[model samples]
Target chain A: MPLTPNDVARLADLARIELSDEELAGLTGQLDLILESVQVVASSVPPETTPTSHALSLTNVFRPDEVRPSLPVEDVLAMAPAVEDDRFRVPRILEEAA
Target chain B: MSEPIFASAADLARDLAAGTLSSEEATRACLERIESSDGDVHAFLHVRADEALSDARAIDQRRASGEALGPLAGVPIAVKDAFCTTGSPTTCGSRMLEGWVPPYDATVVRRLKEAGLVILGKTNMDEFAMGSSTENSAFGPTRNPWDLTRIPGGSGGGSAACLAAFEAPLAVGSDTGGSIRQPASVTGTVGVKPTYGGVSRYGLVAMASSLDQPGPCARTVLDAALLHAVMAGHDPSDSTSIDAPVPDVVAAARAGDVAGMRIGVVTELSGEGYAPGVEQRFQEAVAALAAAGAEIVEVSCPHFSLALPAYYLIMPSEVSSNLARFDAMRYGLRVGDDGSHSAEQVMRLSRGAGFGAEVKRRVILGTYALSSGYYDAYYGSAQKARTLIIEDFDRAFATVDVLVSPSTPTTAFPLGERTNDPMAMYQADLCTIPSNMAGNSSASFPAGLAPEDGLPVGFQVMAPPLCDDRLYRVGAALERVLTERWGAPLLDALAGRDRLSEGGRA
Candidate 1:
């Protein structure tokens, strides 16, 4: 399916990125070209083949249930763009229960 | 001791041990060279001169006190900006984390420090390692040392450029696709991408978790092997790290013998699209190996033709998911944070502001692929294709101990030549992506300069997982033959050019 600029705008929204009108138009064309090339995989892959999400045959890895030293709280908070009382400060999420 | 700046990492280590050269002197030489030439090359994103000098002085003191040190001790090395180092900015070449200093060191960084290697600061890379050339770096493109007008292969271009420019003898690079080897190919250096799970990814900023492998970059295969040994081994911090002992690559590199080894040349990875000079150098290197008593055969892996298409889908899907953490809350650049905007608005605006064009492109592509309607067609089929590609490697490895190809189809292209054309830029990794898909070890060793452009060309060697030693054996063997044929290492020609240019300036 040919991707329209609206489709790219929707994807950008899903990705939590606000795209300008110029970027949306440019990305739509570029992504259409990229998708056109990569879409070959859909037709080429045989149905019986099992998908390999990871390279290694991995099992769940666990460690001893003991506490280990972690990074200092102050140091961690210092990296935050906005720090509150010992925690990350952020813009409010809840719209006042109207 | 014999122009410390251009000496191999192994020779510098030997000199440092023999009391003929102080770590400080060697470190200063590299710093001075970086100071003099980096204006044009722009290889380093950061150069920690004070800290590197202090670390070198400490190593010199430890040696003076008669303490034994490891082989790479006191050697100055460059780290790719993607790795986190405490007390230094770890930008990963993005404005999002422009000046964000990591709270702690990555496992690789800790290991390099523990091995007593001095850190010479972080080198530039594609922002979040998304592009084929260092042109994606938010800072600017890193110019190739051989020809300043051309690109150094990337996203490890800065690391490779530093080695080619004689700024650092050893550097670390991470490869997801061809970031390390492709850059090494164009720069006349050696780069290794150890098997997935062979090296810990604890603090190397996540790209595609399944594909990323941090390895070594150096002027010689043996030097790469030495750094590889220091960096590889199981780290409990990264659950995917291989638990088995690291391959004895150092011994294999020193052996430098390919006698009786079965080397396969993949039929699909060559011809058409490949530059004639690149093909010529690769064919010559293969012939040299055959003359060295290796049994060579042509192997067919038809699925490899689909590697690029599959990688484009799979890598972006993972990229979209992995990059979600850059939301404006915890760290990095936060935009639209005045009291008016909501949290969601802040996230959208900040991400829109922080990321560059290529990063945005990949992230959006990944989002579309992973979205509801197209998930199975794009991401699922790509995963299935990944299986087929892995099976191709398994079948090829079943018959031969290793496989060979040109590291990239062409040599260093002129800077800005492919920046506007994403497809052209993506073509750089065509020959190197299959190994990443299958999670095998692969490397690029300097074959020689291309006849037409006189830029370096890389010969790639692929080995099965945990058999990384085989890569060194093949690379060392080829390096020996090529060095003999060229009458010196390929970079000596580049160095000769630098000398002539300097003399002309005088």
Candidate 2:
């Protein structure tokens, strides 16, 4: 399947990358070649074959629910670009539930 | 005192145990080598000299007091920039994480420290391990020690180059799609990519999550095996880590006997289009294995033809999702807009300026894979194809104990040759990517030098998922044979040529 320019634009947005017009144009052709090459996988196997989630079959390997102390807030926030009152300042993700 | 500068980890450990060399001296020699070589090779992104020396001094003092030391005690090893260190910045060679230091060490980093290995520094890499050549590194590409104008191989080029330049005896590198093995092959070093989940992935900056396996790079198989043994074993922090017992990798490598080993030569990996010199060296490696009492038989995994394509889809899709964490708000290098502009604008500006061109290209491709309507046709189907590749490997393993092939289609090309052509560079990994997709263990060691270009070529060895120990055994056996045939290790062949004339020297 071919990707529309709008599809590329939306993907770039979701990935937080800004694509230039020339880049998008070039990506269109390059991606087309790659997609076509990889499309061979579609017919490589039967549809009924169960998909393998992992190579090995060990299961239920979970860490004990021990509460460990995290790095101090000061150190954690130190790397952030915008911090206010010990909180990471981001463009507010919530706009009050409708 | 610097007697162990270029010694293997095994030799260094033995000597340290016998009081022939102190941990401090070993660390100092490595530091001195890095100081002299890094100016030209640019192998390290960050060097922690004081901390490393301090750790070495402590180990020496402990030994002097008759205290026990770990198997790799006193050895200095370089960590790839992708792994987080508690106090050191783990940038993954990208501007996005330029100043972002993790407060905790990666599982591998903690393991290395626990094993008493001195941390020399952080090596450079492709941005998020994304490129075939280190050209994508925000800090600039690591030059090949064999020829400065050529690439060292990515994204673990710096790790391999450091060992090749005799700066570090052992280094860590993550192989998502042949990053460890490819660079090792090009630089005449030893590297292994253990089965996925064999090494904990807890602190590695995620690239292609399912495919990334942290492995070792060193001058000798025993050195790589020693580091590998320490890095292996289960980690509860990494949900994907296997609970199986870590095999005796160092002992297996020392055994060095392939007698009665059923080695399968993959038919798909041989023949036309492969560089003649690469094929010649590969054949020589095969003959050496046969002379060591191993039987080589042709085996075919037809699904392998689909591996490269499957990898392209799966890798990009995963990269897009994994890299989404680097928005302007969280951490690291960011360019933000004032109150006049919206938050979205700040994210856009920051990411646009932060990422290199190749990284952006992958992110776009990945996003497209996960996009509505295309998900079923691309990512979903590619994953199903991954199942087929794994099954194919399983069936082949049932018949043969191990598989062998040329590590790459060609020797290391000039630096600028494939950087401009991403598709061509991607094709170079076609042979090695299948093993990663199947979650099998594979290794690459110098087979011989390509007669055409006089550059090194590597032969790859693959084994059943948990049979990683076998790769070391076979690789070590072949390393011995090839070294003897060449009259010395490949590194010695380039002795005088290593340093250029005063006019051309960097």
Candidate 3:
């Protein structure tokens, strides 16, 4: 199914980009074209084959469990845009009771 | 003009080691070249002339102390902005990262610094390495040095243009699809995309993590090899880094013989859908290989027809996951929060403002592909196609030692022509994407110029996984033959005629 304008708007909202009307129109056209081309991939390749996620043939790379000293909390927080009480702070998700 | 700016990296290294040329002298020459040509070429996003001089002085001090030198000591090199540099802003040509500075060096940057090379600066690139041309850069489009109005290929265009313009002897570029080879082909420089996991991706800004591989860009094969030798190694920080010995690339490149090599021309990649000039040069390259004792044969990779689609599906899926970490609450830009909304709302607002249209579209497509109801139909099917693509490559390699094709369907297109038409631009990678999908090593070097528009065309050479050394060997041999035929590398041919008009001496 093709994406509706609402779908496009929701995606933009989810992506956190403020799109101007003109930009949204241009992107809508481009997205439609891209979707059309990629649809061929969905339709053509048979179902029996296993999908490839990596180009390299290697598999199952794991590291030994080991503890390493972490950087100081203050040092880590130094780069954060907003921090309070030694933790990252953000806008409240739930509304207050009336 | 001093030859230092345009001289090859190998030559610069030899002179610097012998004290015949000072590192300061070479750095100054590169700075002067950038000062003169960068206004037209727009190859660089930053020029670190002062720090380059300081680094050169350190190299001189090390030489004075009689310390054993690295192979590429004192050579000036450029890095695509996607590679994180400790002090410089590693923007990846996106506005969201306008002031973002990495706290540490990328693995490639660390290795280059250890090798004693002087960094000229970061080159321009497509935002998040998403576009085929550099026009997607928030900073501006990087121009093709051959023709100012035309594009240099992307997301490595800036590096290729720097090599062509003599701004630096070497540059580092990343390849996801044809990001490395396509630009190199159009700009008439040498580009190598090593086998996946051959180079560490520890410090690179993620763009389709599974497909992104950083490699060397230079005017000659040996210089690329020299840089590759230093850059290719295991890094514990990058889980995908291969833990095997790196082949002696310099030695392999210097072996300019393809005798007894079974060279295959990928039937699926040739002929139709290619520019006539590009096809002509590709045929000439094949003929040259045959003349040099290579047994040329036709190899069919039938499933290659589905490569682009499979690639689009898998790459965007991975891109969505990788770019998810860039929410405004983190290191970079933040927007649209008055301390009342939820964390999810803040993330949505930041990403909406931060990412470009192409990136956002892919993320949405990817999210949809991976969504609960659509996983089996879209992303899963794409994965299955990928297996077929790999099988095709493996089957073809059984008959032929290496495969050959044009690096891209066309040479550089005019800037802005395909900028708004995303799929039209995506078609540019038609010939080049399959190799990346298969995790094979590939190289692009100039084939001759196309008389139709006077643009340079490049021929691609591919070898099965871990046979990266062979790509360099065949590339160097064929490049020498072509260069000798044209009297110089293709870029120099244009420069000579271009200079004739400037001096009125032709």
Maximum-lDDT candidate: 1
The weakest ten consecutive residues by lDDT in model 3 chain B span: B497-506
Please, what are the lDDT tens digits per residue for candidate 1 over residues B1-506? 27999799999999999999999999999999999889888899999999999999999999999999999999999999999999899999999999999999999999999999999989999999988889999999898888888899999999999999899999999999999999999999999999999999999999998899999999999999999999999999998999999999999999999999999999998889999999999999999999998999999999998899999998999999999999989999999889888899999999999999999999999998899988999999999999999999999999999999999999999999999999999999999999999999999999988999788899999999999999999999999998899889988876765732342121
Model with the higher TM-score, candidate 1 or 2? 1
B1-506, model 3: which lDDT tens digit per residue? 23897688999998998899988899889998898888778889988889999999899889879999998888889999999897677889887788777777899999999999999899999999988889888899998888777889998999999999888999999999999999999999999999999999988999988889999999999999999998998888898888888877788899978999999988888767788998988899899988888999998889898888777878888888888888867576677668666777777777767777778778877776777777887788888888888999899888888999999988888888987677778888887898888888888988987768878899998888788999888988897888788777666764555431232112
Best by TM-score: 1
Model 1 alpha-carbon drift over 4 Å, by segment: A96-98, B499-506
Sort every candidate by TM-score, greatest first: 1, 2, 3
Q: How many backbone clashes does candidate 2 have?
A: 0
lDDT of 2 at B466: 85
TM-score of chain B of each: 0.98, 0.97, 0.97
TM-score of 1: 0.98
Root mean square deviation (Cα) for candidate 1: 1.6
Question: Which residue pairs come into collision in candidate 2?
Answer: none
Superposition error at B280 for model 1 (Å): 0.5
lDDT of 2 at B345: 69
Q: Sort the candidates on DockQ, descending order.
A: 1, 3, 2
